[model samples]
Structures are given as structure tokens and as C-alpha cells.
Target: MSGEMIYPRGSGAYFEQLRALLPRGAAWICEAGTTLGKLLSGLAVELARIDARGIDLIEEADPRTAYELLPDWERVAGLPDTCTGAPETARERQAALHQKLTSTGGQTIAYFIDLAAKAGFLIEIDEHRPAVVGMACDAELYGEAWAFAWTVRVLPFNGTQQGELPVAVAEAGDPVGIPLRGWGALDLECLIGRARPAHTTVLFAYEVEPEPALWFDFTR
Candidate 1:
């Protein structure tokens, strides 16, 4: 991968295409270089009007610290640190760590979703293979029912050979016609010019108001 930054082209067109596929409500798309944990934390803050509290099992060294600091927020256990055994090649180590993190991350997210649901938020899981995770509100909060959908893709960086690196591609697909969740697939193609593995996070958010004024309105 190259050392310089590489911004993707046709981002607007790509977003427009996704918007067309959104369920009968207004929708918005945003891309970032963060993780699911961070995204959910932000959502919790928005919904609760206070600091979003969750176990930082992904990046934090001391999960207890978060619990101590945010005593009022809901807390859960973090993922256990896994050891990557010695491997003959770099690829093996990379694969091992990737699998470990992905598995743990999914479990943590699942736990968070359940906690949110129990707290009165409606949850929606994308039915497509490897299902994307989503959440929405049943009752109108702040004048509308808010919904959020997100998906993560891990892209491993393959060292450049002969002065060229591979480009990541997310194939375009037909709109998933599910009614309750509303189907809009996120397709992201990114070029990582650096020689390091990275994760791309895609988030969609919209608000549906009550009857008469009920409609999906994209926010952020």
C-alpha cells in the first residue's frame, strides 16, 4: 500500500445509489475509519442524553476503569484477550488475530444489542448472510423514531509487489425488500495505499416521525 492518503471517487454517486434503495423513509450515509464499538457508543450518548456507557472490551486495557468512571451507565464484560500462537508466516499471524478480533467483536456487539433492546429500543438484524446489525425505536422519541444501521468490513493489506497493491471491492447488489427494517445495502470500495490492515465502518441513520408527518429524514 502507498504511504499517501487515497480518497475514493464517486462517493456521492455511490451514496445516491444507496439512497435509492432505502426503505420508504429518508436516509443518510456516512463512512468512517472507526469501529462498531465507537459507533454504538455515540448512539447511546445521543439516545440517553448522557455519556454512552458500555464495556470497552475491545481497546481498553482495564474494563473496570470504565465501570468505575461511569457508574450510572450500563456496563458489560469486555472480550478476553486471546493469544496468537507462533506462526511461520506473517499471513498466519494476521489471519489468527483477525479471526480472534472479529469473533470477539461480534459477541460484544450482540451483548450490547440485547441490553439496548431490554431498555426499550427495537432491534433489527439484516437477514443477509453475515447479517448487518441495526437498531430503531418503537415509540417516537424527540418527535420521531430514530433508526441506525451499520456494517463493518475488514480489509487486509497485502504488501505491494511489482509496485502495485490490490484494491478492495464491495460489489453492488439489489435492494433487500424487507418491510420492517427497510432494505438498503451498503457498498463500499476503498483503496488502502498503506501497508497495514484496516477496518471500514459504514453507518446509516434516519428518523421516522409519527403519522401524518411520518417520513424518513436523514440526519448526519
Candidate 2:
């Protein structure tokens, strides 16, 4: 509301304070319009400028308002890792930084899902279990390997066309056994892969809907 600065005093304020400290007889050296007075005024201006910039630097130290120090924050977070690529925009980078700072490592399905959500994705986790006699008759039979395997089903991005999702899904669908994948899959695999149980395996799946067919206008 008020167009005023409170912390760093202005150049005129600094000049007055500097003049006040001069000794009684020596005060003439800093009298208005004198050479010494002009020099002192200039020095005060520089000091005031530095003081104002110091407050800005303090603000930059905050992660939420950080711009110049964003790289330092990313380094501390160990970001731009194997999965999440370097953020392409300021907002994107800020979001990634927030995720990195707030996240505590976890192994639960909900944990992984929340991790994906932070990266702007919605996902489902399916834990596989070996077929048992009491299981439903129609349940697909899975072997012991399935016991250690889990699938991360990434739902298509909301409001996106059906065609775009498959490409992202395909890029992200690699099994955890292979080298890590990037992009698509929202860098999710890498985020969770690090926190997943060492004994278990991770897999990715994409859920896409079929596009509607074009109708012919021959009847017209």
C-alpha cells in the first residue's frame, strides 16, 4: 500500500548520519556544497545501494521466492536426476524444487503415488500375488516371480488427446530391471525406483482411452 522502503535508509538519510558523526570543528569539512561533503554524499549513496541489495539477497535465500539461487537449491535436492529432466521453465523448476524439499523417502504404494502426483501425474499401483486355490476362478495365474513384481499404472494426463499419452506411456513403460527411462511416465519411475524395496521389482504401465472414430457425411 505504502510506496516506501523501511529497512535500508535512503542516500540522504545516510548522508545526514555521516555528517552528524563529524567532530565539532571538522564539521566544516562536511558542510553543504563543500568538496568533502560531496564525496561523503556519494559514498553514502553507494552504501545505501548496497544496503538495499543486501535485503534482496536475504529474500533470495528463501526457496519460495528464490530465482538467482535456484541452482543451489536444485543441487542440494539432488534434482535433475536420471528421471526428472532439468526443469524447462521457472514455474516447473520451482515445483520440482518444492517436491524435492518436502519429500521424505517412502516405500508404500501411496507414497509412490503421491510422489507421482507431485510431478503432476495421477497413477495406480498394482501389487501382484501368486495364484492360490482360494482365489477367484477367473484370476489370471501368476508365478512366484509375480510376488516380487509390482506395476505402476500411470493414467493419461487429464484433458490430453488419446494419441499423446501412448508415446509418453511407451517411453515410461520400461521394467525396473533395465536401465532407467526418462520423460513421460513423469520421471516417476526414477523417483520411486530409488525408494522402492530392494527385493521387489517395479514396472510401469500407461492407461489410454481409444479415440472416437470419424463419422462420414455422405448422407448429407
Candidate 3:
């Protein structure tokens, strides 16, 4: 006989196991069409249903497979508290939840840049300094408050540079090989704002892609 049984957990398997447990003389009472056999078959169905439900619970515990249980995961992660405009799509939501749970929290510029990159954005941080007597001639004179102000320069979304998702993020449901092609920078802004130091002010500067240089082919 083959080692693999196609209906390993089906009603027939359960019925045979159950019938084997009964007293030897009870065979007549447990015949296929008998009422006792019917009862055993029904019991087997409930057992199979219970086994399936247990498997589903295991799957729901993982963020990658927790479709219906995502809301619960979000609540546990304290989502939408400061991260406004909760993501509507399942992929985005899962990514958000994964990001929240995995973030270790940092205040460094590199930390912020890495955060944005993982979310599919390329950015540069510019720290502002007050104009001093020794400053260069081209420097702008500003108050001391500028010392605590910084700007995050967001480059135009170039799929070649920023479309690559981190391993963990890709595993969270974002499709690989496809670039994030859109103007949804709000999420990146919110993320930076939330993580910035309490006493410091952060500004965002979005750089639009410059028009491509056009050359006349008059020589043709």
C-alpha cells in the first residue's frame, strides 16, 4: 500500500478508527447504513472542522497570513494614534503594522533616511545653522531658532533608486519586481514627523524632476 493516504482525515478513516474501538460483537450495530454509523460520521465531520479551525488560527497569528485579523494586530501596535491616515489597502496596512512593530526608534539622520528608504523613498537631511560673523558670504542670516530646524529633501520618485523593498518589507506583502510609482509622500512625512526629536523642528523639501534637456537634430 502507498504510504500516503489521500483521505487521511476523511469521515471514512474516522469511522474505521471508531469502529475498531468498539466491542467485537458490535460490528452488526455499526454497519455502514446503521444509525450508529451515521452518528460516528457526523462526529468525524465536527472533528475535521475543529482541526481546520486550529490550522487557521495558526495562520492568522502571522502578519503575512492574517488577512481578517489585521485590525487586531493594528490595535495591539497602537496604530493610527500618531500615524494618521491609516493605510486603506491590505498590503499597505500590513507594511505599516510590520514597520511599527519592528522599529527600534532613533533620532539620528541616518536612522531617518533608512526609515524612508525602507518605505520606498529617497531623501537627504539638511541641518540648518544660524548665520555667524565667520560664515561664508553666500550664507543667509537667520535667527538662533534655525539651529534646531532641519529639512528633509525628498528626491523625485525614481523607481531605479528607491523601488527595491527590504526583505522584511517584501515578505510583508508588497509585490517585488514592481516599483512604487506614485506621489504618496504623506506617509514618509508623517513617519519623519513622528520620529523627530521633540525640541527640534523638521521641514520637508520635495524636488521636482527637472525637464529633460532637449537637443535639436538640425544636423540630420
TM-score of each: 0.16, 0.71, 0.66
Best by TM-score: 2
lDDT of each: 0.32, 0.76, 0.75
Clashes of 2: 0
Query: Model 3 over residues 75-135: C-alpha lDDT tens digits?
Result: 8989756545678898888887787788799989899999888767889999989988999
Task: Order the numbered candidates by TM-score, best leading.
Answer: 2, 3, 1
Candidate 1 C-alpha lDDT tens digits along 73-112: 2122222222222445434434433433344323334553
Prediction 3 TM-score vs. true: 0.66
As a whole number from 0 to 100, the lDDT of residue 195 in candidate 3 is: 88
- The candidate that wins on lDDT is 2
Better of 1 and 2 by TM-score: 2
Q: Write the per-residue lDDT of candidate 2 for residues 115-167, one digit (tens) a residue.
A: 78776677889999999889999998999899999998887666562344535
Instruction: Mark the regions of model 3 whose C-alpha exceeds 4 Å error after superposition.
Output: 1-9, 78-92, 118-120, 131-142, 157-184, 209-220
Q: Which ten residues in a row have the lowest lDDT in candidate 3?
A: 163-172
